[model samples]
Target: MDFPCIDRLEMRQRDLMAGPEPTYEKVVTGYELFHDSTPFVCDHGGVLPQMDVAYESWGRLNADRSNAILIHTGLSGSSHARSHAKNSRPGWWEKFIGPGLAIDTDRFFVVCTNVIGGCYGSTGPWSVNPATGQRYATTFPLLTVNDMVRAQFRLLDHLGIHKLHASVGASMGGMQSLCAAALHPERVGRLVTISACARSHPYSIALRFAQRQALMADPNFRRGFYYDGVQPHVGMKLARAVATVTYRSGPEWELRFGRRRRAPDQPPALCPDFLIETYLDHQSERFCLQYDANSLLYVSKAMDMFDISQSVTRRLAAQREHAAADLGHELATTAAACANVSVCMNIEDQPASTTGHSQAETEDEIAQDLIAGVRNAKQPTLVLGVQSDILFPVKQQREIAEILRRAGNERVTYYELDAMYGHDTFLIDVVNVGAAIKGHLENTT
Candidate 1:
């Protein structure tokens, strides 16, 4: 008797050679945060003297400020989550973020920020180091999902957004959204995680390791300091090509490409004979043009190291019942104060609040609140999984939903999309994704 699971695994192997289409466009933004005095500390014990975070906003902040939604981008995404006056090209999530859409920009003030270690306007390996007056390159500190969330918190603080109606993300962005809720649960009233997990699976780790090796193998890599000269484009392209395979499912490749040749007239002697080969090449070429090799390495490492289970376990171990209650009360009070304030980005140059507490002190309080909130978080959460996704399998999504339900969150919901696009379903199946999100948002609101 042929087992269904065995058949599915075989199909996955067959389509493993195929690659999905690359989709990322440059986002134009006029907002940036410059944090020079206060340093950002990384989990791996690395510190940056100063940092800059680039971001973009959509729609207006409601009077009560209860309609704010924070969107976390995937590994290759920039702060540009949707179209604006300066950017005419569609954003990565343009379909679900506009007016009356899934995210409903007309009713919600949406914010998307480039992660700190991103190659975009954010301070990454491409950014100049104040001490050396050169790009950080290989010297850039290792980052974690929490580190990325911390940087975003700074941006939110600068914008005077103390609470989010919902935190939504897909892929790496999904990872960030989970991190944000886990790290600062009180600040996030709802959570939507799609095609992501609490930690990278071993299979994903191996794939990422292969991609990193390809980049380092390039002679032009020069230990990631190639900005002065030739870049390791070849290796970067190879890495992208490898990654594209995991982003799609085997059944998708079989159905879409079907072992077809690029052209019936093409000679077999020429390279890239299969249609799938050309598709991967196109994806690789597009990615190498827009993304930095080192940024890929840093972000991949961050994803691999993310383990929310460990974080939750540690916080629970350190908590005192009464202290947790006290922290929760303090968080509610401070969050109200933060929500009521209307601070502008220009306030970066101004001194700390005149309320007697230093900026560091205020941040520390917020951090503590976030940790305590995570321990007792009971926010409504929606976990979406793509049925064919290999990178972040449906099992992982189920685990996320299960964890939240077991943690006493009564309103947790789980939805699995039966799409053929695999991990790319979040981007490709906009209608289904939007409908589910809209339904959840409406029910919660």
Candidate 2:
């Protein structure tokens, strides 16, 4: 829809454009490896000679540093998970965190960080490469879920947290939490993943692909090298509006904005005449300039490329190829690969079934591989699913629980919530989501 009445004067004054670097220094407490000499290697062979990680922490670490909980953020979340001394403003997950909240800052030390491929106080495509003295932009290496989780563990190591009390996350954060458990089972004592998937399903991938297309189609995007030029405000706005459709359910939308017209008697125009359209426009406008367009593209692609079963299959193949490889040693190598070093892995770009295997066979093999991957994650786990969620459907949550259980995790606690907010139930329905998390954290058995 054309918004011809947006008041270009007001838009010009607001400068509805994001700069190439992050301006969120106040939101982050400190960096993890700002002065370290060791380089961080990516899954796709990208190297950061000296990386910096922006992170925020709440509460205190015990003397032995055992009462720590690592929280992962969704696709666009920042390091500020809650308000603290440095930043008094409420954070994205403020409702779910704080003293006596679901995360219970009074009893646990909660740490959250912006993923590397992010724009919020973290090194992303917007960051200037020290090697070339230029913004990575479109030249940034491809990222995967494993790469993001590895960065988080590096921060954990910096905090001297050898093991976590629980790894917690929702949405994309859920994928990271699950990866942390499967990839580094010995370091994660417990797991809590909400509204997550074991793999990037085709439906979610297609939705994200469409969002990227909308963003890249803008002339201002300039193929992700829009630095020193006009930012892709139009593209980012349209992409966010498209993503808003997948974040909630049809029933919720119908209930909230059912045939509601901005002006019931006014003639329809190309502009937003309906309440839902206006709502989407407002959301898009608010988000369009707050994030870097390039970072969004990179992070979305990483989410699309995430597949937990691939780790399992790769290990099994290694053991088969080398009879001298021991199970304990292989697990250690996998943990190290997910820590700070690269596994030298590439994105799985081939079709799902190409070895003359039927679709059913491929599906079963992936399931078995996922089960094998999580076999070492025997700690107590909690998985929550929203029935109305179309993005990461309830079936995906069920699959995580089933795989964990089949992998011999007897302490898996699965909950199927009937919230109307769809995939965002964990973020909105705090009462139900918090209760489950609180109970899981408090449960000793």
Top candidate, metric TM-score: 2
Q: How far is 238's C-alpha from truth in model 2 (Å)?
A: 0.7
Write candidate 1's Cα lDDT for 1-445 as tens digits.
3354345434533443243311122324454445634655455534565778888889999887888899998887888778788666678888988889998888889999888888778888877776657777777777777788888888888778899999899999998888788778889988999999866778888999999999889777888887766667678878999999999988999998998997778556345668898799788866774787888988987787666754333432243233334334332332321222221111122222121223455644533433443455578889999989989999888877766666667888899999999898998898899999888776744
For 1-445, candidate 2 gives per-residue lDDT tens digits of: 5565366524743463533433434334443333333555555554455566778889999999988999999999888888877677788889989889998989999988888889876778887766567776776666677878887888787778999999999999999999999888999988999999988888998999999999999888887777777788788888999899999988998999998999889778677788999899889887887888988898998888777775533643343334223222433342343232223122232113221223556777878878887888898999999999999999999999999999999999999999999988888998999999999987877
Model 1: colliding residue pairs: none
Alpha-carbon runs more than 4 Å astray in model 2: 1-36, 310-361
Candidate 2 positional error at 1, Å? 12
* C-alpha lDDT (0 to 100) for residue 397 of candidate 1: 89
lDDT of 2 at 394: 91
Error of 1 at 109 (Å): 0.2
In each prediction, how many residue pairs overlap at the backbone (N, C-alpha, C within less than 3 A)?
A: 0, 0
Q: In model 1, how large is the Cα lDDT of residue 29?
A: 49
Q: What is the lDDT, from 0 to 100, of the residue 306 in candidate 1?
A: 66
Say which candidate scores most in lDDT: 2
User: What do the candidate models score in CA lDDT, each in turn?
Assistant: 0.74, 0.78
